[model samples]
Target: MDTLITLIRWSIATYCLYFLLNNYISYFYGISLNDYYQWFMLPSKQAEIEKLPLIFSMILFLLSVVFLNLLLSSIQLKAFGNFETYIYLGNSSLYDAHYIKDGDSKVIVSQTATITYNSSFKNIGLTQNFVSNSSVTDGLGKPQSAISMGNLFASLVITFFFFIPMLGPVHALLSPMLAETYTAKGLNVFKYQWNDSFNALLALKGFSLAKWALSWVAILVLMIYCTFRFPLQQFGKRAMNLPSYIAANQLIEAVPVSIKPIYIERARKPGETQYFKRIETSRRNVTFRFDKDFAQSVYVTAIVDTENNNLIEDKITSHINSHGKMQLKITDDLGIQLVKY
Candidate 1:
């Protein structure tokens, strides 16, 4: 799964790079997408008539693709690495625990459950409650803390160079080498480029139909590579096993569990009745049973101790008037099985 996801990400990144490069060329050289197509399709006689300029443009496009890919790969690695770290930390006890001094409690356990449903009147409402003990963190060492004004400024400067017409590709090619100097000095050169504002701007600058199609094709190829290279394995294995480990030690009588509806789509038909039962959890698995009348699809998430304590999450689509039972099996070897009956 990780491999597949990585491939998808790379594929998307590749297309995005191509799109940006194409747009940059169009904006600077007044060349259209059709012009590129024609250049490749033109007969030898026609090509010979304009050989010099055609060769130059082709060379420029190829160079841009290579440079852009380098820059994009770095950005993708950093961005996805940070996201994976956040997921790991968020679900771990290190980030969710409450340090109680001199208290009999061996570990702080927090549980919360939330339910959301739309009424027959077409109004959506939510109910959430927390039970048992829970505490907030000092907010230190979070991923967000990595972002700073200096990083923002640096990102803006690097990104600005990419839009400077003829000079952009040169900078894109050289920027990684330049960034290595800072990296050797224990600095995060690409961290600044993760800014949301900068990403939005980049997306706006590169939006194009040809780019989208190219990106999709890239995604398909990457997906195939990742599927074979990376096998399906449970993500956050240690964290997922914490409950069973604590259970085995007999340090805690029960793992604090929470089941929440993270998202709920509208009912398929107006005034359709929707039914949901409280989700149940145990050391071995989490179970969700829905009644035949359920009308909307819901994305349900389960947590062991806190809201950030994600154990398993699955999307449940409504099949009206059909009884549904879904179970997520948990094992000590970090093996996961989703059974639907």
Candidate 2:
């Protein structure tokens, strides 16, 4: 319990430091505070989603700063050859009787772990034991670097957040939880002095939770803003509108002629008055007879409907042969009949 608290406190403090520098201090660098507030605290405005380019750029800059900090700190730790170790017990040992002992012959009635190491050198499969003492002295430094890197990564993660939108907050909350679990388990295995202090620091978990909550609120505001301020007219005109030139001439040149009424010959089974139209059998090949008296080309479309009167197929398309008249072939199930649009 104490270890859990310590990890939470450490994670929260680290997160707070990053948040302050990125949001509070970095505001002087041309990014508007209002926009930041909207991004974090307000709902999205559709009309303003396009304006996100600026905010995205700012997030990228911050994430870069974080990455640099994490890189430098990671290099520093690696140079010192510090690493963390853990213990795993055999099935029998984990479940069997155990004893706790201190220096000399002092025994305690509490759960404790026995620690050992693999042989440094083996002779013909024979072994010896030696302990490794390398430890990560700067615990705070590693997490500080991570927080810095995450600040920048969070920017690139913004758009993708819509998919697994809760990842950021989930990550923030889990940092301390994971740390606490590992630290507590480590204490049972080895006499790592720092574990006590580390667990102590993690006790204050409230702040980390607060940071997650705040970030979530900010995202909600940005989404609301995007919805309200969307530029619909510009998109409709450019992407959705039919060309004026095509509409004026295309509709008139195409008209149906010599319409034939098709009939259902017989039902496939008793009480099945209508056959179900299938996608493959609907359109039999069309036969065309051309009239040289008509100078304009006719674009023909075939629409087939099911016995339930539902539109099974309606395709507006044309194919021109060497003779210059348009032809269209449609195929579907027997239950389908033609309709004119």
Q: Pick the candidate with the highest TM-score.
A: 1
lDDT of 1 by residue, 108-169 (tens): 22221111211111111121111111122322121221222333333333332333333323
lDDT tens string, model 2, 143-258? 22222234334432343233223233222322333344446666331123333332333334323434544566676665455434432111001111112322211222222222
Error of 2 at 198 (Å): 15
CA lDDT of every candidate: 0.33, 0.30
TM for every model, in the order presented, reads 0.23, 0.22
Write down the TM-score for model 2: 0.22
**Model 2: CA > 4 A from native:** 1-157, 160-211, 227-341
Candidate 1 clashing pairs, residues 3+ apart or interchain: none
Give the least accurate 10-residue stretch of model 2, judged by summed lDDT: 118-127
